[model samples]
Target: MVRQIASRLFYAIVILLGVILVVSSLVKLVPGDPVDVLAAGNPAMTVADMEVLRERMGLNRSVPEQFVAYLGQAVQGDLGTSIRQGVPVMTLILERLPATVELALWAVVLASVIAIPLGVLTALKRGTWVDYVGTFVAVLGVSMPGFLLAVLMILWFSVELRWLPASGYRGSALAAFGQAIIERDPAVFWNAFRYFILPAISLAFVMIAVNARLIRSAMLEVLEQDYITFAAAKGVPGFVIVIRHALRNALLPVVTIVGLQLGALLSGTVVIETVFAWPGIGRLAVDAIHVRDYPVIQAVVLVSALLFIVINLVVDGLYRVIDPRVRDD
Candidate 1:
């Protein structure tokens, strides 16, 4: 198991190196001078001045030299300062990381809570109205784009019902909880949860639908397997048979979906945050792109790529836990 984990970690390192190479090159690959975009409305800036600025920013270096310099700086945790924001790239990402983390965490939690059991029940009750309803929900969820859902949710829940905040993440849950403790006002925690719900749901609904379908199919297949049949023949309790035997086998594919979707959920925050005015890393990336903030863009891309790789590694570990045979395999 340790060897397998070590092998995966080595591969993850190699993949991250590739990501850094690609992410670092993204600015050069894009057409047009990012400096020109940055200098827009500065009528006094001359070509000479622009050249000087470019040289200072290391755009004048050969690609290989620039890459080496970037790797060297990155090793020391300096991802470069955002020309647009005039702040260190890592600092900006860290400032907003908690909000993004909060949103993504809630989204995934909501999705798994709703999808897993619904899927298992749907599969168990296949060929009935319950299954049909579940299928309809999955289709509806998958069909609707997240932005559209965000808009509709804001309209219905925020405007019409006035039940929840339409958008914007305040302080994180911990902060809210701390405030609750400090002030003896439990409403702080609820307020935090309330502020989180719409955006999280908007982001998660599609994933929930997708995960449900995957779980349903996996469960159906597992339920039809020889082990399941033997367990049934042994007169195991139906609930025990489903929970202990069937559910465990069915989880591998679902785990894969969850792992992959975590990255998707993170990226999807860009749209959700834009719609809801939530301050997160994704929204920061959008602003960076608009201003041609190369350092910020590169940092965001690399961070996201790292997140995807890390989630997959965790998923690989989960595979071993879910089925010990996977370790040997």
Candidate 2:
């Protein structure tokens, strides 16, 4: 396990470095001068002055020099300051990462909680109302676009029902729980949760549907296998055999889906964040792009790529740990 983990870590680092190098080059492909965008409407500078300013900021450097400098600064954990905002790129990402993390974790948890049991039950009752319902859900999950879901959720939950807060993170849950406890309010955490539900559900509903179908299929196949039959013939408790033996075998494919969905959530939350007014890293990246904040754009891309690589490594290592059969593969 140690050897496997070490190997995965080494590969993840290499992938992250390569991604960073690519992003450093790719940010330059954006069709505008970041310095001009930053200095927009500042009548103090002429075109020649702007050129001088760009040279001083190293924007005029050869791509090789720029990449080398970027790598050197990145090695020291300096993701560069945002040219547009005059803030450290890392600081901006860190401030917003918690919200993104909260959203991603909640989305996965909700998807798993809803999907796993439905899938097992659907498999258990293969040709019935329950199975039909699961199949319908899977189709909907596959078909419904997340942004549409996000909009529908906002209208139904936020505008119509008044049951939950509309959008964005709010600190008000801390108020109702008493002033002293408010400082560390579990209530505020609950506020965070309440705001999370709509976005998380919108993000997760399709995933739940897909997972349910996969789990149902996998569990059905596993249940029909010899070991499950042998356990049943041996007079083992039915639930015990199903839960302990059948479920473990059923989870192999579901685990792979979990990993992929999670990585996608981390990468693809931009549209959701934009729609819902969630201040996640994705939203920040979008704003940076609109303004041609070159440094921030590069930092965002590299950070997200690094995150994806790390998640893949973790998922792969977890798979190896869970299934010895996978090692042979």
Candidate 3:
């Protein structure tokens, strides 16, 4: 296991380096230079002035030289400054990371808590009305895009009902929880909950459907295995037979999907974040793209790629834990 983990870590490092190179290269390919954006409103700025700024920013260097210098700086955790904002790219990401993390956690928790049980119930009650309805709902969830659902939710819940905020993340939920503890205020918890609910639901809806469908399929497959038949013949309780015997085996694939979705969610909530005005990495990336901030865009993509690699690595370790057979493989 130690050797396997070390190998995976090495691969992860290599993949991250490739991601940095690809993203940095692609950002350069984007039309409209950052220099052009910066010089837009400044009538007095000559082409000579812009050339000086470019040299100062090291944009005058060849692409390969820039990439090498970027790699050297990145090793020391210096990801470079944003072209537009002029702040360190890493600093902006760190400030926004917590919000994205919080949003992703909320999304995953909501999807898992709802989908797992629904899937189990549907599997156990196959061919019944419950199963039929669940399958239909899952299909509906998958068919609709998250942004559309978010808009509908805002219109119905936020606009009409006034239940939750339509957009915006006030701050990290952990900070809210800490404040709740310090001030002994329950409303802080509620306030955070209200702020998070809409976006979480929006982000989670499709994943919840996907998880439910996958879990159902896995459970059905596990239930048909010889061991499940043996358990049934031994007069095991139905719930135990399902939960202990079937669910454990079924969870291998479900865990894989969960890992993939969770990883994607951490960095891929661009639409939901934009719709809800959530201050996350996704929104930051979007802002950077609009202004052609190459440094910020590269930094954000690299951070996201690293996150995805870490999540998959953790998931790989989990596979060995959940199924000892995986360790042998």
Candidate 4:
């Protein structure tokens, strides 16, 4: 297991380097010079000024030389200064990282809490109305685009019903909870939750649908196995048989899906964040792209790729825990 983990880590580093190199190269190919974009607000800036700026940014160097320099700085944890923000790229990312993490974690938690039961119920109910309803929900969730859903939800829940805030993030729930403990005020947490509800639901919509469908299918297959049949024949309670004998075995595939989706949610938040005006890393990346801010864009891409690699590694560890066969292999 240790050897396998080391091998995966080595591959992950290679993949991350490849991603960084490609992003750094392609960002330069984007039209409109970063120097020009930077100078747009300063009308007195001249051609000479732009040239000097380019030289300072190392844009005057050959691509290979620039890449080597960038790679060395990256290894030392310097992602360079943001062209647009005029701050360290890593600093900007760190500021927004918590919001993105909070959103993704909440979305996954909401999806799992809702999806698992729905899936199990649908499978157990089979041809009943409950099953039909669950299937319809799954289809709707799968078919609806997240942005569209986000818009419609804003209209209904935020604009019309006025139950939740339409846009913007309050502090994360953890921060709110900490403040609440310090001040003896519980409303802080509620405020954060209100701000979180719309975006979390919007982001989680597809995940819940997909997870439900996957779980339903896995449950159906597991229900037919001889162990389940024997458990039922031995007069085990219906709940115990379903939960222990069937659902536990069915969860292996669900675990894989959830892990991949969690990683995807990190990268997939751009649209949702934009629509909702959530101040997260995804929104930050989008803003950087408009002006072709290479440092910020490259940092975002590298960080996202690193997150995906880490999630997959964690999933591999989960496999061994969930199934003894995985350990043997």
lDDT of 1 by residue, 1-329 (tens): 68877888898888878888877776787776667886776878899999999998888887778778988888899999988768899999999878988889889999999999999999999999999999999999999999999999899999999998887666787688888999999998888878888998988899889989999999999999998999999999999999999999999998998889887776557888999999899999999888777888888887888889888878887888999877545
TM-score of candidate 2 versus the correct structure, residues matched by position = 0.91
lDDT, residue 118, candidate 3: 93
**Can you rank all candidates by lDDT, best first?**
4, 3, 1, 2
List all candidate RMSDs to the true structure.
Answer: 1.8, 2.9, 1.4, 1.4
Clashes of each: 0, 0, 0, 0
- What is candidate 4's lDDT per residue for 191-247, written digit by digit as tens? 997888888999899999999989999999999999888988999999999888788
Lowest lDDT sum, 10 consecutive residues, model 4, at 320-329
True lDDT of residue 51, candidate 3: 96
Estimate every model's Cα lDDT from 0 to 1: 0.87, 0.82, 0.88, 0.90
**Residue 292 CA error for candidate 2 (Å)?**
1.0
Model 1 TM-score (2 dp): 0.94
Model 2, 96-146: lDDT tens digits are 877887688888998999999999999999999989998999998889999
Could you arrange the candidates by TM-score from highest to lowest? 3, 4, 1, 2
Please list all clashing residue pairs in model 4, or write none if there are none. Answer: none
Deviation in Å, model 4, residue 118 alpha carbon: 0.6
> Stretches of candidate 2 above 4 Å error?
1-3, 171-189
lDDT (Cα, 0-100) at 205 in candidate 2: 90
